[model samples]
Target: MKLSRFGGILSAFTATMALGLSGAGAATAATPQARATGYVALGDSYSAGVGAGSYDSASGSCKRSTKAYPALWAAANSVSSFTFSACSGARTGDVLSKQLGALNSSTGLVSITVGGNDAGFADTMKVCATDTESACLTRVAQARTYIQGTLPGKLDQVYNAISGKAAAARVVVLGYPHIYKLGGTCIGLSEKVRTAINAAADDINTVTAKRAADHGFAFGDVNTTFAGHELCSGSPWLHSITLPVDESYHPTAAGQSGGYLPVLRSAA
Candidate 1:
């Protein structure tokens, strides 16, 4: 499939680390261990760390780097082996089948980052590039309606499949942070559109969180720790519109450290 024109530049720059701890407050301060006795990763570009910095040559997928949260979390906690099946542009159904299907009795820990592209956040930006906030908001509202109706059941099915595959594994469902702030800019769109996008992101997180709980999986809310730290806010976790290398609607390297890392750590 041809890369979307907006995301093409980011694809060109695709590329993408860790620590440990100990303490009296060991539960919090101590390094959280990977649930996987045998690790396996799943999901999309964010999980793959597409624009967060560097690519893994062996992975042969754009911008999939070692420093991405999954790899970093695994190394920090000392997971000796893992299989990462995360790919750019993956949807939940794709994850359930292609990524999760690769697992078996040996798999222990599983993590996933998904739902945004399925909600068409990226596609909305493409259509609203020359439109008004009202136009974009309309698009967002429509998208949300479609997503809320469709995604929950889809997420449930995926989670159930994972549970069946690795009953002992800790399934981590990583949620998205605010892609834009209350009011932000880029490519001529308005703050309202950004807010709409952020709100929609919240919706995906909410549904995913519920699904995780239902399936006995861990839910990681990256947005909570990143409160007020959206892409428009000077020290944004996501990339600025002008940064050609940063994926059009994704996080930057800083985002991986400031945003993604915390979410993974919280899971620990």
Candidate 2:
């Protein structure tokens, strides 16, 4: 009877040890990689998600949205510690002073979307409306030149400022997503205007990409990633001008999910 009791105890102990080993192996296999730490977002209304998303009442701006790209990126990636300093009217200068404050050595990621405000693209569109294609084209060309010359240096400032504050953090500067496509048209637009705007956007992205590269930051080209989903195509990524005007030019919820999330994931 004593020998039988001892054998039973020995079998149970062996089984417990085997289970522990298996559990440890499974944990090792399932462990998620320790990615970079806190995520910091900076920029303008595009980053803010002004017109088409849920605003955070606590953020003290019509600009800050809970559904904005930064928020979405953070949620999707399970990044709990995030600092989003984006505001609706933010410009290049705005970022250097205000946004850089949120970054520190513990920060792992920084994402920015600027230059549109500096170029005054929104104001130009407001003035030109959809009817004045020639004026629109002219304004776009002038803005392109200004951006090409001025934006690179400003981008360098943003990069340097961020690096200064958060030496180990990876900086990512996102390009504008395509709001217009070749031969596309809106309620007040002709095909000519659409082509010109699309071309100008491409030029803007080119300058942004080059500047980001020079500054040793990652360039998130959401423009190329969203090539087929421009507003005129009836795609959900961008809003068409005639009907849900608020969402026009800005990225849609789908855009944030599909377009921007990939960039954040890659940055990590």
lDDT of 1: 0.75
**TM-score for each predicted model, relative to the true structure:** 0.79, 0.80
Count steric clashes of candidate 1: 10
lDDT of each: 0.75, 0.77
Cα lDDT tens digits, model 1, 194-229, are: 767777888899888988898888999887767767
Return model 2's CA RMSD, one decimal: 8.8
Error of 1 at 70 (Å): 0.7
lDDT of 2 by residue, 141-191 (tens): 788788878877877787778788987788888888767665645656777
Error of 1 at 21 (Å): 40
List runs of model 2 lying over 4 Å from the truth: 1-36, 78-80, 184-186, 241-247
Model 1 alpha-carbon miss at residue 260, Å: 1.5
